[model samples]
Target: MTSLVDLLHHPLRWRITQLLIGRSLTTRELAELLPDVATTTLYRQVGVLVKAGVLMVSDEHQVRGAVERTYTLNAQAGDADNAEVDHDKLRTMFTVFVAGIGGHLDQYLTRATIDPLADGISFRQTALNLSDEEFTEFITAYGELLARYADKPDTADRTRRMLSTLIVPD
Candidate 1:
């Protein structure tokens, strides 16, 4: 079995996490939402998440002789607040995270019409100097700010956005 970080490092799995963030979804429904990805692939990745306890089986029933399942995000498994990971795994996870962001950027740029500025797209590095206490406070506050909007439902005027953060000691 892999850690939550390792399980979530893949693009599809990461997207699965995002989709399951605020609601429950079935594999068939996920396939409908993500038409580009094959259903088999989604099922396999969902199985991995379930095995790692990142996703929970919230409901299930038999459908046409097959068992259909609905899954919800396991908040505890998704939270990596105090997990102690080795340096190598951390580095690999970071690399994968950057690669996933780059892949999304590439896709966005290749689209026929892309207005990065108007779309609120941003990518930049910020250096923050703070003591341990200040850093903890800052992180907590930032998380709280995001939590306010994390579970918002999709609306006619709303668009899903990805926000990634990285903090390294200098």
Candidate 2:
């Protein structure tokens, strides 16, 4: 089994995590969503994530003499306290995380038709002044708000959006 950092640091694997952020999906569904990636490579990355315990096989069933597994992000996958990651590894992971966001933006911009306003796309950075305890409270409240909508099912009136957050102390 690979360490979580080693398994999720790759661009493709990070993207796989992004795709599974709030939903359960099979390898076939992932391949269809990422048509540009070779099916073999995608499956390999998924296997790595599964082995690392970042992804859990939530469901499995037989299909045409083969087993199809539905994978969901592990509940504790993002809990950094569980792992003893070194400073260098943490820095590298942060860099990869930001790069993944940039890559997604690049892909969105390359699309033939895009209307930022209509699509409700926005990105902005702001400085916040808060005490340590207040900051913790803020994060907890923010996470609770996100949890309310994170697991929503797909519907005709809903559009999937990526939300990324980064904090840097000054």
Return the top candidate by lDDT.
2
Question: Model 2 lDDT vs. the true structure?
Answer: 0.87
Badly placed stretches (over 4 Å) of model 1 are: 9-11, 59-68, 78-84
Runs in model 2 lying further than 4 Å from the true structure: 78-83
Q: What is the C-alpha lDDT of each candidate?
A: 0.84, 0.87
TM-score of each: 0.79, 0.90
Per-residue lDDT of candidate 2, residues 39-140 (tens digit): 989999899888878899999999999999999999887576446778988887888888888878887898899999998889899999999999999999
| Clash counts for all predictions | 0, 0
Q: Give the range where candidate 1 is weakest over 10 consecutive residues by summed lDDT.
A: 78-87
